[model samples]
Target: MEQKIEKLSTVKIQKSPDVYKVVDALNRTLKEDDLMFGLALDEDKEKMVFTIYRT
Candidate 1:
């Protein structure tokens, strides 16, 4: 089946050592809902922002 995905929302993540864990959980939740997300890092690489997309 053809899927149409659209940008849903963006969330700013705080800097932390377990940042990967946070992203992983978000990914899992999104996947369960048949959606997807992308991550963007700041210039300093100290901050992360995730954009959630839905189909």
Candidate 2:
């Protein structure tokens, strides 16, 4: 069976951003392997869904 992942929180950031900076910030705020995260962006042809996954 698949396990259910609980959402601790939801946050919004700028689309098509420098992901390294975001990860660095998250790493500082959250402990290693203690959280799950995702990013959202516009799905238009000229836009990109630049996301960085962490846990």
1-55 per-residue lDDT for model 1 (tens digits)? 9879899898777667777776678788779787877777867787888787887
* lDDT at 53, model 2: 43
Q: What is the C-alpha RMSD of each candidate to the true structure, in Å?
A: 2.5, 4.9
Overall local distance difference test of candidate 2: 0.54
Best by TM-score: 1
Cα lDDT for residue 38, model 2?
53
Give me the runs in candidate 1 sitting further than 4 Å from their true place: 1-3
Clashing pairs in 2: 33-55
The 10-residue segment with the lowest total lDDT in model 1 = 14-23
Q: What is the lDDT of candidate 1?
A: 0.78
TM per prediction: 0.58, 0.40
